[model samples]
Target: MLELACISKTFNPGTVNEKKALSGVALRLEKGDFVTIVGSNGAGKSTLFNAIAGAFYVDEGAIRLAGEDITFKPEYKRSREIGRLFQDPMRGTAPHMTIEENLALAYLRTAKNQNAFFSRTSKAEKQFFRDRLALLDMGLEDRMKQPVGLLSGGQRQALTLLMATLVPPKLLLLDEHTAALDPSTAEKVLGLTREIVAEHHITTMMVTHNMKNALELGNRTLMMDSGRVVLDIGGEERKGLTVEDLLKRFKAGAGRELDNDRILPSE
Candidate 1:
């Protein structure tokens, strides 16, 4: 459902501090493919995700979603086809809005009538929101009237996930969505991620620093280094691999062991 071809991005180009964030990065995803990406700092993992999300224009290459070339499309223009969850728990939702209000905004994405206010929830819409929230089983339905600011980190991220998938975009970009949560909560959120992705059959790319998570979730695993994809493994091969095996591959591909402290396996 998504394809990136020979994408490259450079910051402060032609200057002494010129840093290439992405170098000829190419990737393709089928309709329901879930991909987990891992890399050390400055490996271009997040850069690639941001590029696909249209956060900024790439210096070279093309981005296509479901056969539409969106390389030159503005960020807002691509929002209809993409859903993103950032690393920060606070980044995805409006704190002052009630839980239901936030969901109302997301539901608006698929609305045929532009004049309608998502917050003006009809009985039918309310029921729909309630049914969706029930899937989280987080008692969010009861707290629909509560402001999102009052929610815990995990709750906010879970709500963000719900928002991202509400419309079933052509591609979902998860940039360390569970990074800021506590261990137990992160686990719960990860489980929710798997459930939601499977149910919706949405194409997804998840960037994570945790090796175990990179290996455990998603249909494919990609390792990046120095602004390029150094390794890609998936399906039965990835399923049979261990953390140590991934480390070995990283070392072989990058000619050095991954040294990022955050890339270590979670105990």
Candidate 2:
């Protein structure tokens, strides 16, 4: 459903701080593929997602979603084809908006009729929102009138997840989505992630620093270093592997051990 062909990106070019973020990086995902990505700082994990999401255009190469080129599309134009949840829970939702209002916005995002008016709370919309929110089992339905700013970090993240997947875009990009939550909350969010992805059969690419999560969540796991992907493991081979085995493979493939600081312990 998504393809990145020979993509390359560089930051601060022609300056002292010049750094290459992607170097001829290429990736392809079939419909319903769930790929987990892990890499240390400066490994271009976020850069790759940004490139695909059109946060910024890549220095060179083409990106296609569902067989259409979107390399030069602006971020907002690409929103219809992609769903993203950022590292910060606070970044995804509007602080001043009520829970129901936030969901209304997402619903409007996928609305086909351009002439329809947007509402903060329609009975039909509220019913749909309540059903979706109930999946989190977090009593969000009871707080639809509350400002999103009042929610806890985990609650906000859960709400963000629902908002992102409400319409089932062509691709889902999760960039360190649970990194800011507490261990228990992170685990809960991760489980929610798996459940939603599986239920919808969405094509997802998740960037994570947690080794165990990378190894456990997706159908395939990729390890990146510097500006390129160095390791790809999947299928029966990756099914029973542990964190230590993944680290060893990363070191052998990248010619360097996995950075200790980036390998989050199992929570």
Candidate 3:
């Protein structure tokens, strides 16, 4: 479970370049909810994720995850409960580290292993890592000794997804994680995301540019613009919804038609 209340953030306040990235943003997520976000550029989608991930403290509001206040929690401390993925495949893993070594680092960094002062690996843990990597079905299990830098973008992204969920954090933040991959590879990674999140009943939020994916992949969809959540749809309201319907709602909430210059890509 997660809750964000009255979240507001401003950059370069009181200056010529001052801009508010998020404004009075509020959201609640129940366990097992997969909410996909759609918006044009500068709509505060990634800002919301960063605020929750402790990339920076919000100028206002509070954030709580799994019953603890993390409003001012340090980024490293929040890592134990929050798992995040970026559009860049190289962001989360060590390029020089072997496949199993990367997995061990993530496995050891989570809350369950937080109390242990020593970062030790055993055969049992390696076997567990192998089993987890095998789930990707990309032959990574057998390539455990290879450095991550040797992998293709899609392979590394899939491996990052596995690492993020190897322990199933309290919440998962995905920032257009598949946007940079080829269509075929992106489809594969998206399928893996659906399976792993469903299997663990993880509460997750994903930022995406593709409108069709926003509607189709997750149980709920949120539309944000100008730093505020403009539309939140789920259940019957979201069922059978079309891209046209979503655009109309965006207009109603944001007091203008969706920006054409920053159009959301749809299939």
Candidate 4:
């Protein structure tokens, strides 16, 4: 449901600090497809997401979502069709907002209610938020009145995931969302991610620093190096893939041994 055509981006152009972040990077995702990405530092994984999210304009090429060209759309405008989660749990939610209040904002994405989100919610809407929070199984439904800052990192990220996908955008972008969580919590969040994405049939692209997560979580896996996608694998070829196998492919595509320095170990 998403396509990137020969996209490129460069920062600090024409100076010694000039660096190419994305080079003719082209990618496509089918409806309900979940693709995982892995790469070393400065591999353009996050840059690719930023480009799709409209954090900045691409230097060249085009981006289309569900057949609509949104290359020049501003971030707020594009947000109507895209949901994003960042590595930092604190980035998605307003720390001072209560759980239900945060969810109310997310619900507003698909909500036609012109009233301010902070205004009293209807009984049905409050119930809906409660039900959604209950799915996290974190007792957050009962703590809807508590500020988000009171939640643990894992709980906040779980809440963030719910907020991001609450309305099911045309595309979901997760950028190392679980990287900061503890092992058990990370696994829990990953499981929740899969369940939510599947239930909504949301097409997703997740950039992960965990090698095994890249191979294990999604239907397809992509490897990048020096701002380019060097390896892409999926379908039958990806069913039984392992980290060692991916390392081999990375070496072949990147012309060097895979760098494990930045990759998180499997839990």
Scored against the true structure, residue 70 in model 4 reaches a CA lDDT of 96
Instruction: Between candidates 1 and 2, name the one with more favorable TM-score.
Output: 1
Report lDDT (Cα) of residue 251, candidate 1.
Answer: 94
How much lDDT does candidate 4 score? 0.91
Task: For model 3, give the 10-residue run with minimal summed lDDT.
Answer: 110-119
lDDT of each: 0.90, 0.90, 0.90, 0.91
Q: Could you tell which candidate, 2 or 4, scores higher by lDDT?
A: 4
Q: Ranking by lDDT, best first?
A: 4, 3, 1, 2
Candidate 3 — which residues are off by over 4 angstroms? 111-119, 260-265
| lDDT agreement of model 3 with the native | 0.90
The predictions' CA RMSDs to the true structure, in order, are 1.2, 1.4, 1.6, 1.4
Worst 10 residues of 1 by lDDT: 110-119
- Which stretches of model 2 miss by more than 4 angstroms? none
Q: Tell me how far the alpha carbon of residue 240 in candidate 3 is from the true structure, in angstroms, after superposition.
A: 2.0
* lDDT (Cα, 0-100) at 95 in candidate 4: 95
Candidate 2 residue-wise lDDT at 27 = 86
Write model 1 residue lDDT over 1-267, tens digit each, in one string.
888899999999999999999999888888999999999988988888888888899999999999999999989778878999998999889999999899989878767687888757799988888999999989999999999999999999999999999878888999999888998999899999999999989899999988888888888999999999999999889999999999999899999989998875755
Which pairs of residues clash in candidate 2, taking residues 3 or more apart in a chain or in different chains?
none
lDDT of 4 by residue, 58-144 (tens): 999999999999999999888878999999988999999899889888878665556656456688989999999899999999999
Estimate the TM-score of every prediction.
Answer: 0.96, 0.96, 0.96, 0.96
